[model samples]
Target: MPRERILELRHRGRSFREIARETGCGYGTVRRAYWGAGACAAATERSG
Candidate 1:
């Protein structure tokens, strides 16, 4: 699944469970992907 799409859904106030259902992924996977994307973006911002 696209990370940006997941992030967008999350930003739009979708819960991890909701995103998982929509994206056909596990709830844990959705949560991890969202947090991982956030971590990566934060790292990039700090580094840049």
Candidate 2:
């Protein structure tokens, strides 16, 4: 699944397990995606 879709789902209050199930990904994948994206966003905010 796309990162944007995953983030959108997460923004809507879905749990990691729920996102994994809906996106056909493993729980770890969903969790890592969220974390990785957050880290990138934080880095960008700090730099920008």
Candidate 3:
């Protein structure tokens, strides 16, 4: 759920700090979630 929310915020062009504040998570946590999602998407595209 947190990951999805992070992604949603990122898609809306929210900064990491903004996401962290809105999600009640640390900035690094939000940043990592975004990077993790991007990595997963890249892997999926490559595999598909």
Runs of candidate 1 exceeding 4 Å displacement: 37-48
List the pairs of residues colliding in candidate 3: none
Best of the candidates, TM-score:
1
Q: What local distance difference test score does each model get?
A: 0.68, 0.66, 0.62
lDDT head-to-head 1 vs 2, winner: 1
Writing each residue's lDDT as its tens digit, candidate 3 over 1-48 gives 346656787789999898666656667766777777432333233435
Ordered from best to worst lDDT, the candidate numbers read 1, 2, 3
For 1-48, candidate 2 gives per-residue lDDT tens digits of 556766888889999899777656678777777876432233234435
lDDT of 2: 0.66
Task: Point out the higher-scoring one by TM-score: 2 or 3.
Answer: 2
Q: Which residue pairs collide in model 1, if any?
A: none
Best by lDDT: 1
Per-prediction TM-score, please?
0.69, 0.66, 0.61
TM-score of 1: 0.69
Residue 43 displacement in candidate 1 (angstroms): 26
Candidate 1 C-alpha lDDT tens digits along 1-48? 656767898889999888777666778777777877432333234435
Candidate 2, clashing residue pairs?
A: none
Name the 10 consecutive residues with the lowest summed lDDT in model 2.
38-47
